[model samples]
Target: MKFKIRKSKILRNLFIAIGLLSLGNLISVYLIFNTAGVEAKVTRLLVKLLNVNLEANLPTYFSSLVLLADAILLALIAYGNRAIGGRFWHWIGLSLIFVFISLDEMIQIHEQLRAPMEALFNTSGLLYFAWFIPYMAIVVILGIAYFKFMMSLPKKILKLFILAGVVFVSGAVGMEMLGGLHAEVHGEDTLTYALMYSFEEFMEMSGGAIFFYALIVYIEMNFEKLRLRFKPKKKKKKIKKIKKNLIEA
Candidate 1:
């Protein structure tokens, strides 16, 4: 009914996973570029699955799953905070945001905005992707809206949250802008572009992992224990007897 998780162990595993995924992406890129003659079908499939720059692949799924994990953690924290009469809604909002982000990661909702945004703004260079504009606006709005809530957090949590945000945004927006510019100039088929995007994905994944760790730490600090309980089903005969006794009384 109760489960105890070692936070350090979890953090270590997360870092290991991130490192392996990044290495996989790098190897895939290298193999794709260096391999001459027809590649084996399985090798080609592995390359496609491991490439971090490509969509609908292992890296993308991992990222989405990471975001989903963050959302679940945030939701649990929100429930815990609500029970304690703390900042319940703020945690809920974060959970919701992560939920949307997880879905977006899988479906590439932001990517869908690129072409229309480019057409509407006639943007180029750093804005070649054109998706980060709206995303940046949303970030600004969220920053403003959550300013007070962020300020109210404990210094440790506040610092971790800021660090995670910077890391994630630097990759998701900052590197994206630079990558867009690079793609606009040299095009996407280059090794340089692959490396840039790979780095970007790495940052995003790392940020999510850090944020997940932070949430786990927060829960450990604020709650006595994290656990789950399942209730056993009542016997029908017992229920009927209890009902009859109640009626007689």
Candidate 2:
């Protein structure tokens, strides 16, 4: 059977998912702060589900989903550019980057890079995070390269896209800086560390949610009838010959 994928439905589901995740994260925080005993077990479980903890499960999965969404957007843009006879391979490049990002999100490539980068840089403060050094540089280069392209986009799309980027970066890099300093002094086991990490997770997911909504809106605006479905063709029934029945009659 064929099923249509409506933007409205997608929007609703995405919003709901983000809301529920946020609520779960908040509950975890509350439990951590206020309760003890069996509640601690429940809180730990919730934290795992909500991406507040260091476990590479919920957060990784959610980040992968976000990267996949970004990759889809880039793919659509690449198609649109090609349709318009535009020669911009940059969109394809961005899509490929998102693919890598999605994989990296799940596997924690940036985390693994931390040690090497720290050893090389021998820095402190925000730069002590190490990964952020190269990451910020890449962001700068990409921002410069895509400045004109971003400016050329429709106002609504441009605004949403930029908002998504700013939100994501604020959490990923900005909060990371703060968290790094805090960890440097207090270690990662403190309540403050958990709180900062919780906030970071929320921001990352929130950014992804916003970007997903924006992409859906843009696609719906451009191609109002877009849908994804799978339908199986019905088999034809074989007809039996009836000549003998007519002769008998």
lDDT of each: 0.88, 0.74
How large is the C-alpha RMSD of every model relative to the true structure? 3.3, 6.6
Global CA lDDT of candidate 1, please? 0.88
Which pairs clash inside model 2? none
Q: Estimate TM-scores for all models.
A: 0.89, 0.77
Can you write out model 1's per-residue Cα lDDT over 1-249, one digit (the tens) per residue?
123589889888988999999999998988888877327786688788898877899899999999999999898888787666777998999999999999999999998998999999999988899988889999999999999999998789889999899999999988998999999999998999989999999999989988988888788778765444344356766898899999999
Poorest lDDT segment (10 consecutive residues) of candidate 1: 224-233
Q: In candidate 1, how many Å is residue 159 off?
A: 0.9
Q: Which stretches of candidate 2 lie over 4 Å from their true place?
A: 1-12, 28-47, 223-249
Q: Compared with the true structure, what per-residue lDDT tens digits does model 2 show for residues 120-157?
A: 98977766678878888988999999888888878998
Return the TM-score for candidate 2, rounded to 2 decimals: 0.77
